[model samples]
Target: MLKHKCLDQCIACTACTVQCPVTAAAREFAGPKMVGPALERFRLFDQDIEISADYCTNCKNCDITCPSSVPVSLFSTLAKAQYRRQNGKSLRDWILVNGEMFARLASPVASFANITMNNAVVRTMLRAVGIADRPLPKYAEKNFYRQFAELKQQRFPDKVVFFPGCYIGYNDPRVGMDLVAILQASRYEVIVPDVVCCGTPAVANGYLELAEEKARRNLRELRRWAREGWPIVTCCTSCGLTLRQEYCELFRANGADEVASQHYDAGEFLLEMLEQGRLNSEFIPLAGKYLYHAPCHLRAQGIGLPSLELLQSIPGCEVNVADAGCCGIAGSYGFKKDKYDIAMKIGERLFTKIKDSQADMVVTECGTCRIQIEYATGVKAVHPVSLFKQALRFDWVG
Candidate 1:
């Protein structure tokens, strides 16, 4: 639906404004309902575009909070793309949008690049180009796709396809490896297909055309796997949201609805397995209470807190839900130097909650969220899948 069409659903509710984290963090940001659906009402009359739309992190907080089911973030993103096309974009936009290309380039210099990017000179240059000064996620020695080929697992008749998003594939292949270990434990053959980067960062950065192209490729792969009776799963919350909802909501990619229906967040998939009495309930005890921060995108899926619930179920574990809100690193929003302050301010609650709790460590499903947590709070953060594999002492991979 167009912005005009979505505007008709609103009855002037202020709920979105009240719940908007960006608005709370950066006072200048016109909160969701106004900059999003409300501004669309003006666009219906062919008015000028909304400049405030660019400030939206596209976190879908408005969509999640809307009582009227308005696609609030869609309007903002569409407007953003339209504005970008008219005014052109920055070089940083090009780099940030093509997440896969950047990951590939960084892979070759993985170790040195990680060390180099931490310096004042590099950070000064990055800030000039709109990138933040903070330490970015380091590229892994090998991406998940390359690492997948190197792992030897016990094969089984049952099969499942795993979509290792750019973050998991490039920054943290261990999480991907952990999921593989757990799947092998469940006696299922893991299939790693040629899926694109879900194009979430692309869409968020206003590269709508590139995002659609990436989505089309992923859709084709997802359809093929679905046809062969392979259930698709993902560990990254943003990637899963892009595959399962954003493609349809933002880009309107062909066959996206079907692909979305066949998708599952990895933790949610495991919870389903638990309910079905098929999960491998082996013994190994993790002796401490861990804090679990649910990413906004995962909550936007409306699937409840699967990772937190699953962690709590472990006999030797206690999972404490963080007393916080959004982590503020919504895709690449926080990576821009201009927006870094807002992201940090928005995340202060979460960082404080982590410090106050003083849990042994922090765990979250989103890779960016994990990075933000570790960067801000100096607490070791990881994907629950990694924790699961380590706690269970799964011998296949660490």
Candidate 2:
């Protein structure tokens, strides 16, 4: 069912191949154009070759540069799922995909979990399981939902539910807090729902049934707000994309396609706010060279780099759009022991570019990319919203 859509549109001009930084960096590696179609061929004959799906970092550069408008990364993900199904899921897959379970289990003793993650023994175990040379994020003292519950109990004017994804909810509550502060400052009521996993990890790992179940749950929870004409805002690109696209798949299968069409990513939602003159900010001069790493999923959404647009609006900020491709942390792909070296190798070019640029900070919309970039560059990477929040705090633009 997931056949490559743009096969007929492809001119074989090699435009996509040439535009891909991944292919350019790794000459032996097949770019998305070839890989996507090749998977179709492999699937046709029911061949079980792995096709090195783990090699793709899912940066969406191929999609961004493709002239024929192919959904390169989406198809590549589908192909990865195919390969994962044949080769069997890795230990790292089990760890990353069952993130919700781990979060819930760790919530009771979150401090212990946080300490354990930072421990040398635990780091070795993590490396043994597949993650290498990446620092794990510390778990929050309090989860996002708990923090949201406290805020919601108090009175507010306009309410907007915040979907901070699993990482922000559990690992980095600062992001959630910052988002709440921003929404409150904008005079909007912020609600934190008792949300479950967004099912992106499941979908990526080929657990389609599990993903669909989670999607249905999320839809039922958000449908009321949708009916009320309120927007569901998420800070993570994967969560936003899952809400915008995968939830639609659930509706299409259940004969409710129209409702699925209304989901919005944070960038799309923010751009809408900007156009409507609902969002305004005081520019804070952030002195430093800033590079924007567009996440693969964000690029796949075809939003025309709204994150960079938002960043550049702040005066005295030098934003560099990196020619560097994926950071090679394609969710759980780069964390596996077998794929760790390859992931590092793939990420080296981007890391080197960022280091060479001598940027003050790297900003991106995807939480995973932030993690990967920070791990690779040792430069603090943050969400664009955080910078925007900082800009709003300034007294004067000049």
Candidate 3:
């Protein structure tokens, strides 16, 4: 019940509402200004919360757009959590929020899980429970931790701890491998820590207490490495944002400030190495035009398009910033039946732009953003770190 001081900074500028993609796409939404700061005033007085707060995708566009640095999305997210506490949450939300549990249970029988997940009967059953009709991200046969256990890596004096998060650890282990290769080539030993999900899924789904539990668990390990001077890195922008911003902002997690100070997006970390004249420059020319989509979470970090900047460093690489705005996935937000259409509607502008660009590939830092891009536009989407790894090793097969 700790009230945020950010709520006091709202000046009724309406800039947040103007930049709110959800408000623009879905007319039913009361806009971030009204649902967030405005309703927060009543909530502080123990008044009933408005239902419109649930429409917020928690994409953080409002946070990025606020001139006064008001955390509009935080307010909306908390309201959603409080409302759920009173009314109770659905089974669909319970399943969606516990990503780490699902990943661990499914990874052992990945092929069967993947096949069963897409079957008509399973899809129908899932849809009946309010899961979306869209395709789900397939589970990897071997999760990132298992793959990394068998990985042969050269030891370096300079080491960095990597938080793979659930997406890379469960669905796409290859991205993690690519990141390891990239870091190794730059003479840094990669350390994959034993950490839980960054708890974004829980926070977004109104499980605030669960998110705090996760934050504390992760901070125990992350804060240790952070204090030891090993830079903590994550390839997923959402994970980065949650660890560096949300843990402190929403949960007031202890040692979050220290961990946030050391946390960096993989590309952001590499970009810093480049700026400091320490990044490996042995990358061969990679000739391809890639359209890059900046995830709303990455933008919310207030770091200027680090992945886009990193990708541009490759010789002969033509990287264009799509700048079309949010992909609208917002982690598990798009996977709910009720929010799926709204998510797609919010992404229409970006989808249209990608289809017209006809780039060799679409690159981004968020796993869900890549999924949405490919599903909506029929374009292959990959993480920026994967492309950088290819460029570094001259491994482009095309």
TM-scores of the candidates in the order shown: 0.96, 0.84, 0.96
Clash count for candidate 2 is 6
Encode model 1's per-residue lDDT on 60-126: one tens digit a residue. 8888999988888887787888889888988887878877887888887888878887878888887
**Cα RMSD, model 2:** 3.8
Q: How well is each residue in 1-398 modelled by candidate 2, as lDDT tens digits?
A: 43435565666667777766557656556777777664656656776365644456555667677787766666566677777766677777778788888987897789999888879988888877776656666677898777766764434566776777898888777777777776665566776666689888877666666777777777777777767767788888888777766566433434124334555566666666666767645556877788888877776666678868877877888999986667777666566666566667777878998899888898888887788788877899988887777766622211
Q: Over all chains combined, what TM-score does candidate 1 have?
A: 0.96
Give the per-residue Cα lDDT of candidate 2 at 227: 73
Candidate 2's displacement at residue 207, Å, is 2.8
User: Model 1: how far is 243 from its true place, Å?
Assistant: 0.9
Instruction: Note each model's CA RMSD in angstroms.
Output: 1.7, 3.8, 2.1
Residue 154 CA displacement from its true place in model 3, Å = 2.0
Query: What C-alpha lDDT do the candidate models reach, one value each?
Result: 0.85, 0.71, 0.88
**Where is the poorest 10-residue window by lDDT in model 1?**
389-398
